[model samples]
Target: MIIVGKVIPFVNRKRELSSLNNFFNSDRAELIVIYGRRRIGKTELIKEAIKGQKAAYFFVEQALEKDNLDSFKEIISKTIDNPLIAKADFTWEELFQQIAKEEKLIIILDEFPNLITENKTLLSKFQKIWDEILKNTTIKLILCGSSISMMESYLLDHKSPLYGRRTGQLFIMPLKAGYILDFGVDSIEDAIRVFGITDGIPEYIKDVCYRLNSGERLEEVFQQDKVLFAEAEVLIKSELRDPTRYFKILKAIAFGNTKFGEIANYTEFPAPTVSKYLSNLINLHIVNESYPVLVDKERTRNRRYHLSDNYFDFYFRFIYPNKSEIISTDRISGFEADYNRYLGRIFEKVSEEFLKLNTDMLPFRFNRKGRWWFRDKEIDIVALNDNTREILFVECKWSSLNQNDVKHILELLKQKSGHLRWNNDNRIEHFGIIAKKIQDKETFRAQGFVAFDLDDF
Candidate 1:
C-alpha cells in the first residue's frame, strides 16, 4: 500500500547529497554541520545520504543524560555489527575507537543541541573525543541541529569546546523559487504564491499540497483542520524554550511591527530584551531583519523585521487569528473570511517576489533591483548599476494597470526620486512599471516610463 503524504524518500537534493557523498569518498575524514529551521528537511536529507551506506546514526531524545547515553548506545549497537561493541561499557572515546574500525563509516549525530542539553558536558566530551580519537579515524561525522542558537553556541562560538573544529559548515536554506519546477508546480504565478506562502519548508508545503491535491482550497485546508491549525505552534515550540514570548513577537511582526520599538511596544518586552529575542529569532530563521533596498548601513529607521519563513507569515496573517473558527466544521466560512482578508496582501508580496526572482535569473545584469523608501513615499523596485552609477526605478502594481494606475505610480516614482539625495549626482535613465497585465503599456511609455508586463520575467 502507498504511504500518502510520505516524504517520497528524499527527492531532488542532488547538490547536498553529492557534497556529502564526495566528502565521504574523499581521502580525509570530515566533520560536517548541517543546520536549518525545523521541517526544512535537514534530518531527512542526512538520513537519505546514509541510507545505503554503512553508517551509525544517533537521534538524540529529550530525556535525562543517562537515558540519552543509553539510547545512543542502542543505536550504535544496532548498526555496529561487531559483537564487541554490542555490550561494551565504553566511554565516548572508546565508542569512536570502535566506530573508527570501519573502513569508511558515516556517523550522524542528529538533534545534537538537544543531546547537549541533557549532558552539559557533551560537547566538551565530544570535542575531546574527536581531537584525541575520531578526527584521526576514517569515520565521517555529521552533526545536525534544529536549534540554530544552541548549535552556534556549541559548535561555532569561540568559547565553546567544539569551536574551530568543524571541517565544513553547510547552512541549508529554504528551497528557492527555482525549486518549485522540480516539485511539478510549474506555473510561475501558482509557484510564487504557493512558494511564498509556504516559504519552501518541505513539511508545510507537503501538508498544504497534500490537502490541495486531496481537493481542498488554501483556506479550507488550513481552516478546517486542527492539525494544520497547530502548525505554527509546533514550529515555534520546536526551537524555543519560552514559546509565549516568541509567539507574541511573531504576532507583532505579522501585524507589521518592523521596528524594535514597535515590537517592544507590542510584546510589552523591554527594548534590549526584545533586541536579544529578535537576534535569537533571526538565528532560528523564524524572523528576518529587512532593510531598505539601497541602504548601505543599518539604522533604526531603515530596518524592519519580517517573518523569514513563508509558512509562518501565511499562518500568522491568515490562520492564527481565526484559529478557533478554522478548526471547526464551519471552516469553509472561516477560510473565506481569511482569504478575503489576506489574499490581496499575499498576492502583492508574491508578485513582488516573482519580479525579484526573475530579475535575479536575468543574465549579464551586474546589479538586480528592488524598491526602497524613507518616511512618506515607497517604491516598488529599485535597480542600480555599479560601473555606470545609474539607477533604474521600478513600480510594481499587482492589479490591472490603467491610465489612472500609470499616473499614480508615475507620481509615486517622481516623489521617490525627489526624496533621494543622489538624484542629481547619479545618472537617472529610466523609470518602469511592473504589472500583471498592463492595459495601457504604450500609454505609460508615452507618459515617459517603460512598462513591463507579467511576461517580462
Candidate 2:
C-alpha cells in the first residue's frame, strides 16, 4: 500500500474500513473527504483502506502549486504504469484523466488543505476538472486534511465550489481508551497514567508504550516527544491571527478557568472577544463548548468550555507552563507533584469514554451520558436511559478501593444523585464505581449495582 508515516498496526477501524470498501466497490467515481486534527490516524486509516487496490497516494505539503501537482503526476503515472507523466510535464487535468481512464483507481490526496493554501483557486480548479472530465470515471477520489476548520470552511462549506461534490465524509477522532489499551501497557494503572493524558491519539499511545516499557515515568514520556512541544503552537498559529492571545485563553482554560467571563478576565480580553476566539477553537476541534449533560430546550444556559484535544490540553497544562525549565533539561523535577491530582481528573474522562462503549458497565441502552454537577455536587458519571427510566450514577477512582471504600463512595454517589432534578420521581437509579482496581467486585454485584475495574474495560 502507498502511505506515509510509520506503520501502526491499525485496530478498531472496522466501520471506517467498511465505509471505504463500499466506495471502492461502487460502479462510478466517488469523492470522499476525511479530516481530523493532526496525529489522530487519518493517513493511517486511508492507507489501510486502500491496501491492495489500484491507487495513487499523494501527500500534499505546503509548497508551490506546480510542486504539488508534479508530485501528484508522478504518483498517478507510477500507479497506472504510464511513464509519460514523469518523462514530460503534464497538466493536472490530463494526469487525472490518464490515471482514471483504463482502471478502477483509488486517488488519495492527503493533507489536502496544505495544497489549497498554496493555490487558493485549486478548489474550484479541481471541481471543474471533476465535473468536466472525471465525473463518470472509475476512480474513487479521497481528499484528506488535518485542519478541521479549514477543511470544513473551504471544502465542505455551502459557498465553496467543492461543497456538493463529496460522496462521503469521515471525521477520524482520537481513539478511545479501550481501543488503545491493548498495546501492552504494563497494567491498567499504567494505561490510565499514560493514555489518560495522551487522550488515545495513536502516536502518543506509541510514545507511552515505549516510555513505560523502558522504565520511564509517565512525565518522562513527555520529554521524549520534543516535537509535541511545538505542536500546539503550530496548530494555534495556523488557525488564529493572534496566537499569543489565543494561547493565554487556552492556558487559562487548561488551568481551571472554564467560564466565559473567567476566561475573558484571565486573558484580559473582553467577553465577546473571548467567545469569538473560543468559536474559532471549537471550529478547529481544539476546544469543546459542552452544554449541560442533559439536553435543555433553552439553548443559552450552562455552557462550559474545555480543551478537547488531549495533547493540547496536556501541553498547556504541563509543557507550556514550564517551557523555560523543560527546555533547560529533558526532566522536570516535581513533575509528579500535581500528577496524582491530574490523573484522578482524567481517569474520570477515561472511564466516561469506556462507559460509552462497554455495555456491561451500562445496561438498558443509555441515551445520554457525561459528568454532571449541581450547585455544590458533582457526579463523576450520570448515564440516562430515557425509555427505561434508568439512570446509572458512577464514581471513577484513580486509586484502589476496597469494599468499605466502595460503600462510602457509593453512599456519596447516592447523596449527589439525589440533587439531580431530572425525572426524580419516575426514574430508576443504580449506583456503581470504576477504579484502577477494585478489591471486591462481587460485593457490589450482590447488591444489583454495576462495578468495574480497568480490566473490565
Candidate 3:
C-alpha cells in the first residue's frame, strides 16, 4: 500500500489485480481474456499484474500481418535481450513459442481483436498453437481488447475457436462513485460531478482528477477539444459501422426517449431497426432496458431504454447539444433548467447507491430493490424485504428539502405507496427521502422516517 513513485495505484480493481497477480505463482499454463470498452484500463491492469515479473506486453494494432509480426519481434527481442531475434523472420506462433521458453512469461496480447480483424484465421491459429504447444508451458497468456462485440463473438462464444480455452475472463467495468471518490477528488460534491461526466472510467478519472488538482474550471473540463470530449466520438466511430444511425438512436435515448416507439419515432428509424440498434447498444454497454421493478416479464409494456451509464447520459445531454457552444465559448453559461433536472435524475441513481451502502440503517434486510412505478406516480428507491412482508419506499429529491418540504413529500409517498399494490392489504411499509440535503434530517428520523443528505451519502 505504500506509494513508491508516480503510480496512482489502480482503483477498484483489487479482484482483477489479484486474479492476474496469482498467475505469477501458478504452476499451470493459463489463457485469460480481459475486455471492455476503451479507456477502461485493461492494459494498465495487465501492466500492474506483471510488474517486476517476467512478462512481455505487445499492444496489438491494426496493420499488415508481416508488419505486426515484425513489431512483436522487436518486443520479444528487447524482452529476451537478443537483438538477433529481430533480424530474422518468425511467425507469430514461433515468436510466441520462443517467448514462452524465456522464464514463466506473463504474455499479454492487448487489442487482440485488431489482430483477429486483420486476419480472421488468427483465432484458429491461436487455438491451434495453444492446444499443441503453449498448453504444456508455464506461460500465462492474456488476450485483451476494447472491442466488446468482437471479443464476445470471436473468443467467448461456443462457436469460437477460443471458447472453453480460456482459464478465466474478465469484463472490466467503470467504477462506482464511491470507489472513484476514494481514489481522490476535491470533495464528494466534485466526485459526483466527475462521475456525472466520467462514470468512473479510471482514465477519465485521472483526467478529471488532474484538472481539478490544477484548479481548472468546469468549463475547461468540458471544453470541446478536451480528451474526454473526443473519447465518445472515437468509440462510436470504432464500434459502429454506421455511426450516424447509431448517433441518432443514442441521441434520442439521451433525450429521454426510453420507449421503443418513442425512440423509433424520434430517430425516424423503423421499430425493428431501433430494436436492433438498442440491442447493439446494450451489447456495447452503452444503453440498457429496464422494466417496472415489480412487473412480471410477460405482463409489462412499460420497458424503458436507458443510456447505461452516467458518462453517456452526460455526453448526450450536454456535450452533443453544446458542441457549437464548446467550439465558440470557453465559459459555461449556467447550470439551470434542463441541466439541473438531468443532475436531479443522476442524483436518484447516486442516492440508490448510497442507500445500498447504508443498508444497515434499514429496519429489515431487503432482498429486492429497484424503482417502482404505476400509472403517473413512481417511487425512486423500492427496497423490498420480501421475507418480512415489508417494503421501504423512498423519494429522491435533488433539491435542498427542509423538514416541512420533506413532510409534504412523505404525504405524497403515502398516497403513492397505496397504489404500489404489492400485497398491499397486509404488507408492512417503511418510508424515506433522499435529497441534496435535508433540513432537520435527524428530526425527520425521530418522526419515524428514513431521511438522508448528500453528506450522509
Model 3, CA-based lDDT:
0.82
Best by lDDT: 3
State the lDDT at 265 in candidate 1. Answer: 93
Predicted candidate 1 versus true structure: per-residue lDDT over 1-457, tens digit per residue: 1124444335577889888988888767788999877778898888888878988888887888767766677777788766656567877777777777777788888888888887778888888888888787777899998877788888888999888888887788777654554454545555555665677777766666667666666566566443566777886886678988888888888877877888899889988889888888887778877666767754445777888866787777767766676656545455446544444455455556655666543222436464577776777566667666666677665567777878787777877776755556666556777676787687766766667665654
Off by over 4 Å in 1: 1-15, 51-53, 63-80, 184-186, 224-226, 264-273, 298-301, 328-364, 368-370, 402-404, 440-457
Q: Candidate 2: which pairs clash?
A: none
For model 3, the stretches where C-alpha displacement exceeds 4 angstroms are 1-8, 80-84, 331-333
Tens-place lDDT per residue, model 3, 1-457, is 1111234666778888888877667888889989998888888888877879977789887898788889889988988888988998788778777876765778788998989888999988999889987888888888999988899999999999989989888999887788766656636666777787888688887887777667776558878657877678788888879888888888888888888888988988888888888888998888887877788868877888898887788888778767877778854467446666777788888888887887898777888889987767788889997678989999998789876899999999998888887888889889999888889899988878988887886
CA-RMSD of model 1: 4.0
Task: For candidate 2, give the lDDT.
Answer: 0.80
How do the residues 1-457 of candidate 2 rate in per-residue lDDT, one tens digit apiece? Answer: 1112334467677889999999999998889999987778898898898888888889997889888888787777788787787766777777766766755688899999998888888888899888987788878889999888789988899988988988899999887766655566645666666665678788778766765666666666666355566777987787678788789988999988887888888889987888888988887888888765684728665777889966777888888888777777876668787777677878888788778777654656788888786656788888888888899999998888888899899898888898888899899988889998898787788888888887786
User: Which residue runs does candidate 2 get wrong by more than 4 Å?
Assistant: 1-8, 361-363
lDDT of each: 0.72, 0.80, 0.82
Q: Between prediction 1 and prediction 3, which has the larger lDDT?
A: 3
